[model samples]
Target: MKVYNYARIIYYRSPLLVQILAIAFSLIIIFGTLLHFIEPDTFPTLFDGVWWALVSVSTVGYGDYVPTSVVGRIVAMLLILLGTGFITAYFASISGIAATNQQLFLKGETAYKGNEQIIIVGWNERTKGTIDELLTKTPPVKIVLIDASLKENPYASKGVHFIKGDATRDDVIQKANIQAASMVLITADQSKDEVAADMQTVLTILAVKGLKENVYCIAEILTSHQLANAKRAGADQIVETNLLSSFVMINNVLSHGTSPSLLNLLKEVKDSKVCLQEAPTALIGATFLDVTHEMLQNESSLILGIKRGASTYVNPPTSFKIEEHDLLIAIIH
Candidate 1:
């Protein structure tokens, strides 16, 4: 009974298609050998017997090989009767597996096992827009989206893989293949209150960094008090949604028409994004004005600021001297 249960465990663990093919092949081998030996003249070779068994069971009888002896005729009849059903079952299993896989994929129960994929944790208008933009890029970016509230993949694009789960859990993060990801973007959970959402975001960052310390993470923090906690949780960048929204509203009220232009300006430069580049060795002691002029002339890049350690100086004095370890904040086209 123990041995039977062990065998059953392995049998169930094995793929359905594999078991079906194994049974089919076993049938072909047994009959092929029997036919070859039972009637040597008609089926001279084992290869000939296997070919006939395969063809006959598949319902493509070529009539090249036939059995005349009564015993051989009986064997042929038995092979056809028993083998055909399993052979037909093989094809049926293939279609069934494909349909099941498609269903699992649509239900967001499938795991993504690829590398360099960008994992986005949230489902909202923002995530939808971001995914749409990523899909439109040349040499398209691979994306895996994780959201507990979603029941199915929201996008029909093959570029996105969706996993429905809590991002703060290890099992879900592993399903997203976070260890092999290039970076992760975590948005505040809209289902929770502001404080709880920020806590969730920070907890997610901790879970991700614990698995892959070097994987870059950008987490959204809804409350100001959680800013230090998010930083401590190993987020490479923090998107202060509340601060940004407040600033946008303030700008719209004060400057009237500038907010639209500001947003348009960002859209216009979508192809190029702001990045931190190692400061040119030659610009170590150069003035900000000189370095800016040189970059604009040589690289067609506009210098945005100097980032030193945790501080950023945007549009600093033209005479500010560039330091050895300063990172040049610029939009490289």
Candidate 2:
């Protein structure tokens, strides 16, 4: 039984084309020797017999050589039938394998070759919007998606590449080329509970950060309680999606139409959208009031406030000094 299992493994592991060619070559050689012995007087050389056997089996029957003996003709007939059958089956098998490989490549089983691309781990409604928004940038960015739930790429554009695998796995992160990625965004799994989803996001964050410490990682968390855990897991940014959703709901309850206004403010219009742009180099030593007026006059932007480190101060005092590395929170549209 062990020997039988071993033989089966070897047989399945070998390529079908190689196996078919080996079998066909053996059959041709065997018949060629038999033909030479049976009709030694008709064929002076064994090479002639082998040549005849190949041509007959291939149905090419060039008629350059033929077996006059009845026994030799019978062998020729059997060789033609068996050879043609195997040849047809071999071609069919090759076509099937080529088709299967193409489908696998399209479904993201193949490794991504793009570099300096965005890596999006997991899938949700927010991810779709993010992808659409990214494609509209001044210079569009390539995005690599890693998700186990998707069977194939949902987007039809070439800007996005998909890999079907667990986001929390190191192999999957490596397949997405995390080391060369410009940014990594991990979305919370909607199918799992809040805690489970946040845990999965944290695990992915840790895996990404472990591989590339400098790669910017933004992770989505379902609950605000998991914010610290995500940050500890090495995420550079943690978006509390559930908390933001609750705030929107609360705002709608307190003031009707407030949610729509907030949504519009956050939505992207054409190529313009609200962003936290870095403070201009010339404005490093200027006061808030000076920079705000310059931005409004020159760039036609509304200066909301400033984001320094992890803290965001909205509508800070006009006298607040604008420092280097400060992010200007403003409305671009």
Candidate 3:
């Protein structure tokens, strides 16, 4: 019983393709063994019997080794009736399962089972561009897009999984495997009014936090007043699209091609990013100039400034001291 249990565990643990192939091979071996014993004169060796069985099971009548006796013919008839049909069904099942799984995935019925994936809510042009940029990453990031409007996964070809449900709902977020996600982005739903969209974004953030509180979340707040609401609902960052666009537009108007230059600069800095990290132990109590010089000389990273608690100071005075619990803001290349 223990051996049988162990065999069952091994069989179930194998991939579907390997399990199917094992069964097919087992059937072929049994049929070949039967054929060899039934007609020793016709099939002189076990390999010859296996060859005949293989050809018969594939329905490819080569006519190389014909069974002469009545018992041998019965064995051939059984192989044709069972083995051939099973082999035909085997190929059909493989194709059918693959097609069915694809359809299910596109329909957003399948749950994402991977870890450290990025989940973006709302299906808009901005989200689409974000997904394209994230996909350009070297190791390939898995992104799950959740929206209630889309009938099926529009970016299925690009390997983006879709969940066709309201992002504010716990069940829908669970389908995305939210607990294992690295970050969640709640884009404002354009279908709703500005205020309602921000409300929905905040709700989605709450739903995501309910499942995993520590997961970082970014929400888009169309209305300025809703920014605080989004943060209160567990949003780590809030993107003010209108304010940011207006800032860029005004700069572009004041100086022609300013937006283009800024965009190019952003693109150039893709390989190097501004990041905040806990201050190293050695940098404790060090002056700004001392830390900056040491960081540039040894680490090649620019020391932007020190972040003490909730306040961030960029390029503090040369005499300013770094505390023990301060975070260092730097541009890492």
The most accurate candidate by TM-score is 1
Residue 294 of model 2: what lDDT? 98
- Model 2 bad stretches (over 4 Å): 1-94, 136-140, 156-159, 268-270, 281-285, 331-333
Model 1: lowest-lDDT 10 consecutive positions: 151-160
The Cα error of candidate 1 at residue 231, in Å, is 1.1
Which residue pairs come into collision in candidate 1? none
How close is each model in CA RMSD to the real structure? Answer: 3.1, 6.3, 4.9
Q: Model 3, 183: alpha-carbon shift in Å?
A: 1.8
Candidate 1 lDDT, tens digit per residue, 96-215? 889988888888899998999999999988788889899888888999999999988887446589898888899999999988999999998888999999999999999999999999
TM-score of each: 0.89, 0.69, 0.76
Give the better candidate number (1 or 2) by lDDT. Answer: 1
lDDT (10s digit) by residue, model 2, range 30-141: 8888888989887678887788788877778899777887898898888888876776677788899899877876698877877899999888899998888788776778
List candidate 1 segments past 4 Å from native: 1-14, 69-71
**In every candidate, how many clashes are there?**
0, 0, 0
Candidate order, TM-score descending: 1, 3, 2
TM-score attained by model 3: 0.76
Give the lowest summed-lDDT range of ten residues in model 2. 265-274
Deviation of model 1 at 124, angstroms: 1.2
Q: Assess the local accuracy of residue 286 in candidate 3 as a C-alpha lDDT between 0 and 100.
A: 87
